[model samples]
Target: MAQNPAGASAAGKPRTLAGRCGSANWVCVAQCIDVTCVDKCLAEGCEQALDALAQCAEKSGCGPDDSACVSRVCGKQCGRTFEPAPPSPEKETTDPCADASVGAGKVPEEVVGRWTLEAASIRPEERPRLAGQEEGVDVKPRPDFESALVVTSGGCFLLRTKLEDATLGRGNTLEIRSWGAFQVDEKKDTVQVWTKSGQAVGPVCGKPRVIGLSKGKFQRPVYTYDVEGDTLTLTAQTPSRQTFQFRRQTQEQKEQAE
Candidate 1:
């Protein structure tokens, strides 16, 4: 892993693959993030950090095909080829609940439900990054988040809140049923949801001042159905414009034995 160059970032963040993933409750997601960081060249083992970052940008998610990656990484002066993430069992899921029970909600809610935010330093005026993730250090400054969470039917919510261990997140503080409603456009299949409290939700001290959800407004949210094998990615931005991602979870309840 890489660390921030001295006198550069005051908060000495990891500049390499080792320190990127902050905290992941799921095995697959964490592994994917590690792969993504390597693909991004954020890890230090690569020598030149920017060159590595540029090279990594060209890998996996940013690439068009298995070989092509983002121009930034590909265009780096370094004479090298960015290898793609090899196929792995980490991609397999036998649990029926991995996807939604409808037409396009194939994303796993449990994976998609919650997020672990480390920092969101982007400004809204800048090009908005996608709602997804990478790995990094644990949060330092806690933040404030909405009091309510929302979810679709046959679904449940999962989130790492902003409240500290002293207040909202104290003993028995997490309430699974304490969720907000997602307004879905039934006709168009679009959807939006909001926090019942403030726009920001989560630890009061974490970076990324706000974890704005993928579906921006509380009005409508992009929905999921029974689309098979489709990946669901949701990024949240806080007031400070930090970014985070979540993979949606789904499942099928057994019909009562008549």
Candidate 2:
């Protein structure tokens, strides 16, 4: 997990942003600012805007709704407001693998193996194609993504994914490695990974879209798996309900490739 610059500066305690507004600078003095907002501002080097917000907060005497107050004040100086992001609609814990239908036996046992990604694709409906990308043309995900997953007998899993998208920006790539304990319902043919707080590792693209994924378990998407001989397929639904697919790699294939 990446430590916040503000928090890291104070020997683990959050340090206030620079400002001189006395008590009204409550937002700056906050033990922790909204990470998403702060990160965005820092990325853009918006110190002046931050200082303006601090000054506004100090003068305005923000009420109980600190977020709203910050938004209202910061908007004036920054030309944009800072509202808490809307909660993911996918927060409902609906298990898609609830039905005990296809798998021959326990899902955990069936999924205990390594899988290599062959291809990946993102639906256009979920994210609009970048400029100059022809509509209706199938863009192969292999060039943009390299990923693999390993599931262990002891109900643990490790996944690594690296993606490159030139359209995002010059030389920007997203890399993520996540590990956590997993839960499987044998009867339901379902699996969900309960990630620990700081499991995500490695550098990721600086694009705002990928930045959120740096934490890795945002909303903790659910997944269901199917195995057919040497072929294993796992399907996952994103927070926006977009499905992603992954295929398994045999031990022989993995070793030979290595």
Best by lDDT: 2
Q: lDDT of each structure?
A: 0.26, 0.39
lDDT of 1 by residue, 12-90 (tens): 3223243222111111111111122222222333334334443354442553432233433333332231111121112
* Top-scoring candidate (TM-score): 2
* Model 1 per-residue lDDT at 253: 13
Q: By how many angstroms RMSD does model 2 differ from the true structure?
A: 16.4
- Candidate 2, position 187, lDDT: 70
Model 2 lowest lDDT segment of ten: 20-29
What value of lDDT does candidate 1 attain over all alpha carbons?
A: 0.26
Q: How many clashes (backbone N, Cα, C below 3 Å) per candidate?
A: 71, 1
Q: What is the C-alpha RMSD of each candidate to the true structure, in Å?
A: 18.7, 16.4
lDDT of 2 at 175: 39
Cα lDDT for residue 93, candidate 2: 18
